[model samples]
Target: MTQLTVFGTLTTLSPFHMAHAGVSAEIDQNGRVRKLGTGTAKLPCTPTYKVPFPLSGDLAVGFDGTVRAIAEVPCLPGTSIRGKLRRVIAKRIKRHFIATGQLLSREAYHCIQCGAFSGDGIKANLTTSAEVIAADQQLFTGIFGGGPRLFRSNLRTHDSYLYCAETEATDVLPVIPETTALIRAYQATFAHPFIRRDDLLDFLDPIAPDVIENYAEAFESWQNTVLVTQERKALDRNAALEARAAKKRGEVVEKPEASAPTEKQKKVMLKGQSALEAVMPGVNFGFRIDIRGDDAQCGLVLAGIVDMIKEENFGGKCASGYGRMAAHLRVMNERQEEFPFLDYDGRKLLVGNQIKSYDDALESGLSQLTSASFEAIYNPKTEPSPRKGKKTDDHDDDEG
Candidate 1:
């Protein structure tokens, strides 16, 4: 069985900053430390974080502190990829599952990217941990695994994409005794990590046992009501319109006059050099997308993803031109056949017998879909909590 495989490279055009760095101390007119900014105080440091996945032992004993070796494990979290892809999917299929129509989950403070339950691909309930272990058996749970749309399995971010991190040659060598050099002038930076199906399952293990306990309950109690974001609810235009109409009807309304809108400012915290670490440009990461079958829905999804890369920049700093990268897409069959989707500007998808790409569909536009669309999908209110299985408490150790 030939699945749809998409393999490509992501060439970073600029420095990628997944974090927000406040301007630290700056250089004054003279060669003295201004002492105002929150520059790190680690005494000329490099980032020391294992922010990526597929956790390794490379940083075992004295590697990072001694060698200051630049690691090549800046893996783009699978969740992040799912997020970006879903946004693209939402834009194309007119499905807003990625952004809108969210309900505060039963779990305290648990939020989301709006997800679909893959249901372990059984369309039935799983009663035991053994079943979960068994079900996961023929599954492809990698970053590009097409399982989400194929097996109907529920997945919350678990895949880790790949990236490369390099160390400067000068940093690798020491001044005197390689192991005795107490003096150094530089540090190395690394990327994220690459995770597999097993690696991502770490997030689900907590909910493993009773995941499908209330399967029917979830599907049954699901609601289709659309709720705007907390922010939107405050600025509802319909309420304002209603207030104006009520006043025109000779009814005294208590609506206040509109005031100038003030933009909310983010508070910046000052941190010393201990807080700086990021991915530099000129780094490339390769990706592979494999789908179970070659279907139009898949084709539309691919097109939507391409459009996202074309319209928006990658990573976090688009406004500052930080995460700009190129995505090349193509479709292939088991017979080693390849369809260069990128070469076409969605024209090929448009001329098909049916609507192949959502670029033209009214329902496919993301802006058109909102909390209302989720009404037709699954309800977050009904989603089973990530916490499952036997409970543990202080009383467990007490005698009856």
Candidate 2:
């Protein structure tokens, strides 16, 4: 007889032994130890004899292995390590592009109608769509070789698909509105490296004055959001600590005993649990925003979308519960927008509010406004995208 334990995400324990080699072992829903195997071979009493189990799934016995009694294996911690690694990788890739001055290119800004931006002072918007596609192609080929070629091809195809889908029957000559155009331009401009010089003034000269100011503003806004999230997490931790202290001191903390949870409470808890699981899959969630154009438009667009989703009941039901959900949104242009959303079953949820032209979104702040509109569009729906295929090498990693 052999005794072995299986550990995985499911809360059920399946025991296997030599006698039940072909049959499946029954496990309870709560994952508790239930029954032992029946196969037994009595031997002369020896002081050190113990049963050994092989780590491999194969049940066949071989002559060279020693027998030892099986013991419980410790459970592995889920996803925290993977999350850290993902953040590191995203940062590294961002830095590499910035250093190489390959984030933006002159060829990215050809005029759609006449290709007039070929000369100086003609005004141009960063071609974010093209730049991101190029950068991702470079990264995929550089790191993973031919494996990511299909992914790169898919992304290019998707971009073209989006372009056609979003722009069909629309004219291309209209000037994009100032606000939206600026956002796109900013994304393209900032992606470029700041040229180094002997003097501080010379170093600063390479960077556009407006670019520096805009980055500072965006950075400040990001900092404020991060601070608030940290403060909320701190408050939750403090409350938990206080509760533990009160229980230790024998203080009468008024609370309900373990009566049956109400239907609403049960639903909220279930949603919270699901959100937590969605945000942190078996691996850590990661995002990379590659701005091939002048500004981090896509990244900013995504951040704005995440903020709206967090506020409007996407992360379970309440703010406290939302904190427990632990979503990490990374912006990477080469791939489609990939992030875990409970509403989307942790799959890519494309909210296509395709405008006739970039000018339409620019004039109306389309990305920002439509982000909210799309939330309304998607909030009630639970269906996954049929377009979402199996996890390929090019698919962005998700945690949940």
Candidate 3:
């Protein structure tokens, strides 16, 4: 199988944030806030070589060196890339092509609701859409993603990072008393070189019983790398939140609990936490794409990436200015030969063959997603009527 590596840096135009699953976030009986998860602090992800410096901020100076740490998204997940690129390409199709309403291909043949595309269509016996997507369409499956495959090389992403200097300033800027305390907390993991591997979990998975347990010591040596917050506005505290974004739409926005920082805790805030965590503009994090596939498949990926660079931003807080990055896509083969997709300035994909700069692909993509399939896919059953039966003359009606 042939492979190509496209590597570049995600130079943040703004701060990025992603709180992973294992992060410990809690408030004790003392009302002190402790948030443990910050993806950048993970032991497996930290880089081997680092040029440590103080947490660069007006407030970072207060925290003792032992606790000063920064949090980052660590790596840009492949799903994020796939999803965003899908949307970008889909949107372009919608913008220049698709009109008011058009239906799209539904899930898979296994569906009790839909079974048109697959060979065996019996609703009673289901063969999942996931299976078909993986087998039938390599463009949808092989290039971007689909179901898993054996003996196959597809696309993958590398993690990004935080470029924090030292963790000196502890005093949190724009100190908002309680709401900022959690950000004020710090979690540190051991960052030594011997135990770190960019793909640690990949090695640990499906635990090998036959092989001697060699990594136990290395795993035990792992510690919580520190997480420090620079002084920052309590976004939840001050914002009208309702006007901002109601998170789960239609749900009431929860208010931030009032936390009174103790003198000692206040010093931590004075040190940093509420201070900062976002990889502000001008910071650069590494990003790479590894593709192990054929030329046409590689072209599809390159096209999607070009759209991502020209029109999209990766990572969190893209709603604001954060996560926007410049990606230079280069195709590197096993022979160490590199071909820069420099022609793809990321503006648009050229339609080849019958479709020219003058000719266009007939795109049937659409915005009207809430159609008949909405109910078939997953629609909530309506609430039962308040009244079971019609009112009778004999029954007295309730006051209006």
TM-score of model 2 (CA atoms): 0.17
What TM-scores do the predictions have? 0.40, 0.17, 0.41
Instruction: Rank by TM-score, highest first.
Output: 3, 1, 2
By how many angstroms RMSD does model 1 differ from the true structure?
Answer: 23.1
Which ranges in model 1 have alpha carbons more than 4 Å from their true place?
Answer: 19-72, 95-113, 116-276, 343-400
Error of 1 at 322 (Å): 1.1
Question: How well is each residue in 11-113 modelled by candidate 3, as lDDT tens digits?
Answer: 4454554434433332333322333222222112212112223344442443444434343224345556656766654454334323545444344212212
lDDT of 1: 0.38
Mark the regions of model 3 whose C-alpha exceeds 4 Å error after superposition.
19-63, 67-75, 90-103, 108-137, 145-153, 163-276, 342-400
Tens-digit lDDT string for candidate 2 (102-194):
342223212111122334321222224554354333322211111111212111101000011112122221122222211110011101111
Model with the higher TM-score, candidate 2 or 3 = 3
Task: Give one clash count per candidate, in the order shown.
Answer: 22, 19, 43
Q: Which candidate ranks first by lDDT, i.e. highest?
A: 3
Q: Which sections of candidate 2 miss by over 4 Å?
A: 1-284, 288-400
